[model samples]
Target: MTAETAPLLELRDVGKDYGSVIALDGISTTVRAGEVTCVLGDNGAGKSTLIKILAGVHRADRGQLLLDGRPADFGSPREALDAGIATVYQDLAMIPLMAIWRNFFLGAEPTRGRGPFRRFDAARAKDVTRRELAAMGIDIRDPDQPVGTLSGGERQSVAIARAVHFGARVLILDEPTSALGVKQAGVVLRYVAQARDRGVGVVLITHNPHHAHPVGDRFLVLNRGRSLGSFPKADVSRDELTRLMAGGAELDQLAHELERPAT
Candidate 1:
């Protein structure tokens, strides 16, 4: 798609309120086809609220959600999935004990035969699972092995590949690298790039600007439930983005406080 075209997913002036508390305030961002939009924020910076709205777990209190330039509202997670929006949370939603093929087609398994003779197509599923994983640049030695046996990064790769195979137009990844070690995080980041290369609009929600900078086309910084700023990669430097995400003023204040002499 051309740059002039509307993004695959766009949130315009989105806001969320819980009683008297505003979880997100006038937040707006876009995830374009073949681009990664990294949402950077520290704890309680409204990242969760924004992801909930995007994943259809919670509807925005106000503002418009547009998919391909048309208005959209998802009443449930199923609706969102049906609309080609897939959310791969950090938890991964996989059965650790289940085999790779089983986990790959867990909820939506393909079956063969009918009339009381229906059975899971284990062979087809395994072959397809293996091929799909390989296509996504994941090298799994065995598709029948338990998911728990796979490393964190490999499991993440499987989740992403599953979403893409299921025809996801927009991928919302919630802190995919948070729980992983440095090397594992790097592995997942490569998969994120792969997803983008496949023309999927990726929404990578994380606190690490360094992780986001390499793969992101645009960065959206949130602080105290409000958007600090959103800028294209070309417009913002890595250091500036890091400082914004780290809350520069707060960090300076803390530094000053620590530097004060003891009473």
Candidate 2:
């Protein structure tokens, strides 16, 4: 892609401060359509601050957020959703007890008939939900089954499919695989690729370099509320990314400390 093809979402010199504490400083990144931009960090690496800014849960004190080459300011989560930017946190905002179809259209439901006489279109909603999930290669045994019955990876897949079906141009997924087993995490990663293949800009936030390396086109590494570096996948190897995120200096110090004789 060239500079003329602006990113679907861009954060320029973004900073977030809470009273006396600064969560991020001059952080900048971009998420392009048909690509996965992985944001890698250890705990307290300003990942939360960056996502909150993108999701409109918090506003930046400085810098600009541009969507499709236009300055964007999302006053609230709803406003962000209205702009076709959907965020799926690790928890996925799903009600496990609710049926799959119900969870699929939790906040936004389809209605039939006139305004005053409008009623939930149960049949159509369930049908659409099943079809959409199937299109994403997610085979839910039954739409009426409670969401709790689905596996962690399945739930995340449903969330991604929902976002895509709802016309989301950019999908910000916060650690979608952090809580899953190896097999389950792989499932979610496949869905991440599916979303990217469908032309949605995907922002994948994770502490696992191994998980991020395969599907990511670009990688942004953060530590102690600061960005260590950002590089295209072609420019950095997976082993290199692992070493960087693991803190090469800190690891070497620990290794030396352990090998040294007792004082």
Best by lDDT: 1
In TM-score terms, candidate 2 sits at 0.96
lDDT score, candidate 2, position 68: 90
Model 1 has an lDDT value of 0.92
lDDT of 2 by residue, 179-258 (tens): 99999999999999999999999999999989999999999988877777789999999988887887879877888888
Q: Any runs in candidate 2 off by more than 4 Å, and if so which?
A: 260-263
TM-score of each: 0.95, 0.96
Tens-digit lDDT track of model 1 for 1-263 = 45898889898999999999999998888889999999999999999889889999999999999999999999988899999999998885678999999999877789999989999999999999999999998999999999999988888899999999998999999999998999999999999999999999999999998899999999999998999888999999889988898899878888889896988
Please report the TM-score between candidate 1 and the true structure. 0.95
Cα RMSD of all models vs. native, in order, equals 1.8, 1.5
Worst 10 residues of 2 by lDDT: 1-10
The list of candidate 1 runs beyond 4 A from truth reads: 260-263
lDDT of each: 0.92, 0.91
